[model samples]
Target: MDPKTASNLSFILNKPHDVEFKSRDLPTLSDPHDVLVAINYTGICGSDVHYWTHGAIGHYVVKEPMVLGHESAGTIVEVGSAVTTLRPGDRVALEPGYPCRRCGPCLSGKYNLCPEMRFAATPPYHGTLTGFWVSPADFCYKLPESVTLQEGALVEPLAVAVHIVRQAVVTPGQSVVVMGAGPVGLLCAAVARAFGASTVVSVDIVESKLAFAKSFCSTHTYSSQRIPAPENASNIRALAPNLAGGADVVIDASGAEPSIQTSLHVVRTGGTYVQGGMGRDEITFPIMAMCLKEVTAKGSFRYGSGDYKLAVELVASGRVDVRKLISGVVDFEDAEQAFEKVKEGEVIKILIAGPNEKKE
Candidate 1:
């Protein structure tokens, strides 16, 4: 395929465990609010990997070949006539989901829950893993001088962490316990600390991940692989003896049954618990324990209205150092290898460069 004639060069998942590069027509501005971006970097999220391995996540099945990426940042190549916020050559981080503005959830400022949301890399909606992509001008946040396109790509996951922190109502001087030490988990811990959590304890099964957490954002890290699920609460409390009784806020970014069960136990009475990760749809939950403690448990989805903006501010302000979680990066041609590394659970966060860049 001639580079000049090709409309788009994209890394697509033809099916489960099968991904390849294909040429397609260039995407045009469908709406006046649309801005065409020359993609610079895209972070491979866990959901993208799940789709590659399992062919689906819950009801969002991969019925057709779809582009595979959502965490992305790029430079604006074109802007629609009415688009005023962004211009050509402006660097931006794209918010992958476009929700219907007329929905009740949207009207109430909880647009992440909008039923008519068209999310990238979510089944029908093609993602941003391509040479060029189009997104609403409002959803594309311009990056500051200090934030690189690589760090801009991290804004998506950081937005998720911000949403989790916001939902949990993390207050100053509160004790926070974050389960799991993957990218999101680490970001959650980072956001919690940025939100003014006095003590942030990170619990994970892997020692390396725990070490990363301790160095990244966590005040302390604990290896919980050997602890029984039921004893996780007490074990976590023992690690953070500074907490009066238990964690004031427990955010389970692990989504493991044991982690979820442990969250209910570790959170102090009248404390908040936020479910930030996606594991099995069904689990053996300790319902009675939750009720007995009157824990305010809330389920966090992607992100809300101010999350992306807040995430950007957090990055630009240097309070939440997103670059700390970046373990490695690969060029566009090595996208498959990057995903493979993620599958093998070898890195914290790996970013894939755009097609214009040479493999390094």
Candidate 2:
């Protein structure tokens, strides 16, 4: 049980609802610019839970046992000789995905769209759940002294919201309607608010989530009531009376078909609509409504360059408070319990203390 000689203990998923703690080889720097991080905190993501219960998400299948976690922050335990931006003992958020630098999307700074991206907790790629994880120095965003490692773990989802809101091009004085008051939806509302949107309304079927969204970031909230998309849209518009007719931008953070359909009706003419959630690969769209409104529909994948950086800034500056979203934290020994809590709708967001985490 010596500190330095301990193996790399990882929480791995062998199949749906079948997970185990296995010791893997401690990760080492793969390049001169890579750094080895001792993960301190990790957030339970929806994708992680999906892989746990379904063993696959879309095309990404867990053909083999894969480490299960990606949203993480850790202390750099060692750095390669070429790493100058980060060093040993530095606290950083581990950006789980890295692309081939030679890709066109990468050269254009749209690495999130790169064809050959290796995203952790995704198929064929190990995640940051181990005692030690390695990542390129540039991908590991350094956290401000004021930010806790647990908060740093939130950068991943916050960056996701950042990308979605940016895709909508929300401007100051404009109104935005975000469908689905989950973590991403709630954060989308917060990010839009931070972007200076005059009114941000969060809509959801659950009254509790709507209640949380109202207090968390949104200027207004609406209950979907399982009505027709247009009726729901009209009710949502009424919540943001500052908006003329409808919202300037609409975002679907809930991949539910009804939410997606409502988003199209929620946006005003010539406004933008961004789909940030992952539902079915195919869904029916209201093409007529889109054409009539001339709405610009865009799909937001994952975060790209500057998204994570801005997410950190938004939190560090108190513009977007991620701390309010966190519901609880559990030690690494109890990581499975954290997943179960999220699966059962018991918490908003939960963080897992990394193996060997130092207790305060």
Candidate 3:
């Protein structure tokens, strides 16, 4: 077969908020297990903004003009010979990571930790922020009729929240405190409620974001900036008495130092605390408080094996109203402005339509 040549428009990151529309060759399926998708919508993520501004996130650096989106949904236009689960015309959410199935982590069902994982929008690996993207068939989950392409695009981040909830092992009648009202934090609160948490508190410095959280899932909202920094656990207990009074779990989606510190202080002894966001690689944590409380701390990476499936199910069943989180939709030409909105912390989730004529 001859090599298929096609043009795809992508958001290229040259610097912070320095995104430009560029034409690139459409990617091809290198293996029989691959599938090609015509992207419909992609969401602006925090990591994408970090890469645009800093050119790197931790060890992953953008050495070339890399496409800048991972959370996406699209229609399958082509399928490889070995692919049987998905077919042409199927609308699906693209799971951005493709791991080497032979790796220890992958074989153990923890593919998110696979050392040889090739994830989109993560330096070196081109992302799905384009007119067309090609991915492994197994990673493209079919969307049900109830799920819209916009909601499908949001499943990626929702899966992250699901994974955090799973890691925390939240149970019914428990209380959860999510430290961030960003997309992930809001989703975490939503997922926590869906998972049967009796009370979920979402905290953030932004009052508008907190209000948004309340509208979606949070039972309680706190503007952390308004509260004085706790000098110790007792101080935190006083400030957040209701939440600190024996909360079962605390999820830190903010990735901020103060949030992390407060999570440890607010969680009851022997309760779980999961770090769902990536902030500085290292931060000054209150180790003494964590040890004294015997807090169980875990760092959550991206979604693992069952997370994407659960996220899709949540959207399909209407358990998670992902569409409510979408703040605005922009055309592919205005994709840069979408990223700017996220950078300015002005939007919750901005969905960028693929390269197509604008709908009337």
lDDT of 2 by residue, 1-360 (tens): 233785578999999999999888777667998988888889997899999999999889999999999999989888899989987888999899999989899999899998999999999998988898889899999999999998999999999999999888889999988988888999999999999998998888889999999899888888887688888888777774676588899899999999988888888999899999999988997889999999899999999989999999999999998999999989888999999999998899999988888655
RMSD after CA superposition, every candidate: 1.9, 1.4, 2.6
Model 3 residue 315 CA deviation in Å: 0.9
- Candidate 3 has an lDDT of 0.86
Give Cα-based local distance difference scores for all models.
0.90, 0.90, 0.86
The residue-by-residue lDDT of candidate 3 on 191-237, one tens digit each, is: 99999998888888888998989899988787775353454334434
Q: Count the backbone clashes (under 3 Å) in each candidate.
A: 0, 0, 0
Return the top candidate by TM-score: 2
lDDT of 1 at 267: 88
lDDT of 2 at 256: 92
Residue-pair clash count for candidate 1 = 0
- Expressed as tens digits, the lDDT of each residue in 1-360 for candidate 1 is 223443467999989999999877888888888988888889987898999999899999999999999999998888998998888889999999999999999999999999999999998999999988889899999999999999999999999999999999998999999999999999999999998998999998899999888888899887885576657678778876665477999999999998888888888888899999999878998888789889999999999999999999999999999888787889887899989999999888999988875555
lDDT of 2 at 102: 91
Candidate 2, residue 130: Cα displacement in angstroms equals 1.2
Q: Give the backbone clash total of model 3.
A: 0
Task: Return model 2's CA RMSD, one decimal.
Answer: 1.4
